[model samples]
Target: MLIMGEVHTGLLRNLGELSETECREVLRLTSGEEPRTWQRPLLYAISPDVLTGVDCRLPSSSGARIRGTGTVSHRATIVGGRVLQGSSYTTLLRSDSDQRLPWSHYLAAPGVVEVYGRPRWQDMADGFVTPEPPMDVLNVGAISGRLMGAVQDSARLDRKTPFKTTRTRLRWLFERDDARGDGRPAMRLTLGRDTMRTLRFTGEPTTDVVAFCEDLALHDWLLTTLQTLIQRALIGTAAPAQIAARLSPAIDHLLHLWMPGARVEEPFLPFWEELERHPGFTRQWTSSVARIRDQITVNTLSLLSVTESRREADGDPSPRRGVPQDRTQSHSHPVRRRIFFRADQRSRRRS
Candidate 1:
């Protein structure tokens, strides 16, 4: 089986975390249908699955236009009442008939795209992941963005976010173990500007591809958001206090949302484990978070030290209060930057 999907993840446009009730209301996409909610690990909810019809050209790496027709599944989610994601995917199944099927037939099998005519499936897969697929191609991301906008632009949300982070899109492909001739697992992860692509071949017989995709998207969003936040923070140039202030939003809303593979099925865990070993998504996230916390700690200590020094300066019973305080006598370091500045600079160099 072949499946290609896209997920768009972003910080829910809210000043702070939304209540469980509010999250439910915000994700209510279907009329009178309540969104699915769970409490374990953290507050999580998913809107009922919706279907979107697409009769468009499939992507072709060789520039050969292949036609595909069918429906794409879309759903919205709220994680920890802070992060929001819109996911859309289609399972590509070979159609025995070359003729177009009735609309009712396509509707019956929601989220399945039946490929028409003879075209290399590999070419189609390659085209989909290409940096720039042809304009007139099946774009799962574009479809996903609309659903994302629907929830994100909802009136229920105040659209007031603590940090200025935008949505990150993940485009991925997954194939079953039996489909491959050799039957060995395979995986590839690619990161670009505000976008990521994952290719996976799993030997396990599991039907949790959508869940896995969303999970990957959620964690990748956390990773991408922090990576971008640190860049804009000007770590080396910004003082410890300033940097900490810049990263406070992440600490408040995102740090607690780092539960990886929490909701994924047991069979697909190895793919995530492989990624952790190589590119190391969680590893980088942990390092960045540790540095942010360290900055906060240093900022707190620096403030207290300065406060104590000022108390001593003022407590001096001598006539020093009357005279102008010497700059050398100040307790606060003139160079306010902390150890993070050098560490960040060296990391940048290595990168």
Candidate 2:
């Protein structure tokens, strides 16, 4: 069996994060099926499943002109009421008949694409992660992008974003671990400029393929976005205040949203564990987050040092160096406990 899918992840172009009610109002894609909303580990909402039909040339590693017809399932999701993602995928198999089938026949099995000839599973899987896909091939990314556009163009959003960012594409392929045949799994991931490719070999019956891949895509995107933010901030090279200004939006929007494998199935736990053991997704995230916080702390200390220097130069009235501040300013500007928010404690240092 061969399965292929694509996901597009980005920050929703909205002025403020949507509330639970607002998320539901935006994700109501189908009439009868209510969008699933949850808040246990994270606050998120998933739109009802939507299907799209395709009768076109299937992608093949050997450049073979293989025709396929079936429906591709697509859906939209909102994470923490802030980020938006569109996912689309279709499984492939050989059909009973070699001849082309009617549209009704394909519609019967949603998200299953059948080839006219022998199902070239390897060719299809390889072609999907190819660097240069053909012009006349199955473009799952386009199908996902349209759904993303639909939500981005909705009236609920203000079409304004906190910071400039573009969506990323993650194309993934999965197949049975035939060579090993030992009920083990392995995965390979490649990162490109604004694009990614993931290929997996699994022996277990992975029931929640789409959901698990979507979770992986989400975490990958988080890592990618944080890398960009840090590079743009230029923390060590730039002025402390300047770096702090560049990283403010990250603290407000991105830092608190790094939950890996939050929605993965039990069968895929080994894959996640292996990934952590090597590339260390959580380790990279932890290091980057610590860098941002350290820069913010330096900025805070710089502000305080400058304030005290000015006070001593002006001979400001005060009890002593070790004395506590007056009660008026003490309660006004509270100290930042976690530094997740801006440090507005300059008032505490003022005369």
Candidate 3:
């Protein structure tokens, strides 16, 4: 049977944001500090049976992935009136199922680490969202293995068969090294950067990164909208209450392009409901927004080439969608309750 549970920390998510070398460093440190029973250098022993390691390739957008196989250890702590909890998943495999069973365990207590240089916690939020298993990681491995398969099977996507499976393990140790004096935990679980070797992609330039970013423009626009709303709220010029009120309808209309479920009939249910329901929104929001910005910079440098290519293909020159309406155009806004209240006034519209 498959077992899974939610943890509040975002360590894994933040780790995903790091580069491939950084990820390997995490694996190295984790493995070196706590060697697994398994012989592989990539695997770390969280406990006698639990192991943790990197399970996927670095997304062209960001890098953060942690895969564990074995029994997990989990723990909780109370600090400054707030609860800080961290868990180590023991990824274990069974003969009956291909899925790895996550042991819902926690460290006995929280650990502590010194904050080095300027600290950024943006990616940490993705961690709290709690991912829906490591499907992307598994996909990356499968995609690679399929192309390099010794015996290709047309019906099988996971090229690594049961008999040819490359078993990798990973583990983490969250130990309380100090119990007194400093308010921080003696051993806190946070990402530590270390040196690692880079693994090259299988093919060179099969697809240009610029085109990929263009495809994700809609998703980027949503993040930009939310970020603007957040900035306004932070400045106190925009009411948090009002901004929250408009969040759902805004998210719905924004996400409708990529996700049909985002187009809900109801706009005002609790303001935070959309954010709460679609936790992945935040993850994609951060990564996609950064990716679009990066690609725009790259495209700008290669603008001449992109322009010439576009000219050759005769691509649409229309503005790439997503621009906020003026206050004068409030009548066209979806969150305007008066329009919804008046069916006759509603404009026939398509996002």
**Per-residue lDDT over 210-317 for candidate 2, one digit per residue giving the tens place of the 0 to 100 score:** 887888788887888888888998866766666787787889998888888788878877777877887898999999999999988777665554444445558985
Q: Pick the candidate with the highest TM-score.
A: 2
The full ranking of all candidates by TM-score, starting with the best, is: 2, 1, 3
lDDT of 3: 0.26
Worst ten in a row by lDDT for model 1: 319-328
The whole-model lDDT of each prediction reads 0.79, 0.79, 0.26
lDDT per residue (tens digit) for residues 1-351 in model 3: 111122221112121122333323323322334312221221111212122233232111233443323322232211111111122222122223234333332122111111222222222122322222234532222322222221122121232321111111111211112212335422222211221111101112111211121112223334445454444433233322333333433332333334212222232122124333444445656554454344334323233333333333576443223422232232333343332323212212311
Give candidate 1's error at residue 265 in angstroms.
0.4
Clashing pairs in 1: none
lDDT of 1 by residue, 1-351 (tens): 578889999888888798789888998899989999999989999999898888888988888867888999999999999999999999888877788888999998888998888757777777788877878888888878998889988899898888788788888887666566654447767777546555555455445888888998899889888887778767768766667677888788888999889999888798789888988888999999988888787766665444445556589533233433453244346344234344444544754
| TM of each candidate vs. truth | 0.86, 0.88, 0.19
RMSD of 2: 5.8
Q: Between the candidate structures 1 and 3, which one is better when assessed by TM-score?
A: 1
**lDDT (C-alpha) at residue 334 in model 1:** 39
Q: Flag regions of model 3 displaced more than 4 Å.
A: 9-17, 30-70, 73-87, 90-351
Per-residue error for 292 in candidate 2, Å, reads 0.5
